[model samples]
Target: MVEAARALFVREGYHATTLTAVADRAEVGHRTVYVRFGTKAALLRHVVDVAVAGDTAERAVAERDWYRAALTGRTLADRIEALAEGTAGLMERAADLFEVVLQAQATEPELAEAFQAGRADTRGLLRRFVESARTDGLLAETTDPAWQEETVALAGQAETYLLLRRTTGWAPEQYGAWLRRTLTHVLAAPLR
Candidate 1:
């Protein structure tokens, strides 16, 4: 059902997609969809959750293998590169749906809350990354950790990702490389 809804939402948009269409695509009953999700906004939330986590599994992003791999790198640069790749992959997958959220949130109160929560969640992840790097002495003594966290969070945001993709016509790999290079520069540059 989540997959069905995601596809429809991406293709037909949030307003155009209907519960019945989702049910039909998923080969489930309409009542089953309603009973499981309750409302379209709730189902959209589920779709974003599944997209962000990369699966329907009950695992948090921090617990996922890719994210853990980023933390386990031997060098800070290595870790940042891995983290960039992971973050880029996530943006590539979910940024479109995030665009949908931006468009639909005006009328959808739940979507507005979800967007705010998602931003906080993104910031929390970036904070954790900053903490992990600092713990390993990856950050320089003069570099502001708060600045790094906020900058990276903003750099990796869905809007930025989508804008770069739309304007520069860069592929996902290009975006990932840009992220890695940008962070490397940010980490090395003195920006107090």
Candidate 2:
């Protein structure tokens, strides 16, 4: 049902998509969707969450191998590269649906709140990474971890990926490489 909702929401846009249509696409009864998810907003939120989480319940983004590599990398460049690689994959999976949510947020108060909440959550994750880098002495003495965290969060956003990939015709690999280089230059400790 979540997959079905994702497809329909992407294809039809938020206002155009209906619980009945989702039911039809999933080959389930309308009442079943209402029973399972309770509301259209709830269903859409679930779909977005699942899509961002890579459609899995077993592990979170922080627990994923790529994320672990980013955290455990021996050098700042290696950490940035791993982080970019993981972010690229996640953006590829979630960018379109994330755009949908962003657009819908203008008209749906609940979706607007959800969008802000998601942004805050992402910022928190980036802040944690920045804190870890600071703890590892991989950041310059002048670097502000909060500022670096916000910068990295904005730089690694889905909109940036969508712009570079869809507008500028950069492939995912190119995007990842550019992100890694850019972030490395911005966040890496200076060479003595």
Q: Rate the local accuracy (lDDT) of all candidates.
A: 0.85, 0.82
Q: Find the candidate with the highest lDDT and give its number.
A: 1
The sequence of per-residue lDDT tens digits that candidate 2 reaches over residues 101-160 is 887888888988988887777776767777788899888765356667788888777777
Q: Which ranges in model 2 have alpha carbons more than 4 Å from their true place? A: 143-146, 189-192
Write candidate 1's Cα lDDT for 36-88 as tens digits.
99999999999998888888899988897777877778887888878888888
- Give lDDT for model 2: 0.82
Residue pairs with clashing backbones, model 1: none
**Against the hidden true structure, what lDDT does model 1 obtain?**
0.85
- Backbone clash count for every predicted candidate, in the order shown: 0, 0
The list of candidate 1 runs beyond 4 A from truth reads 190-192
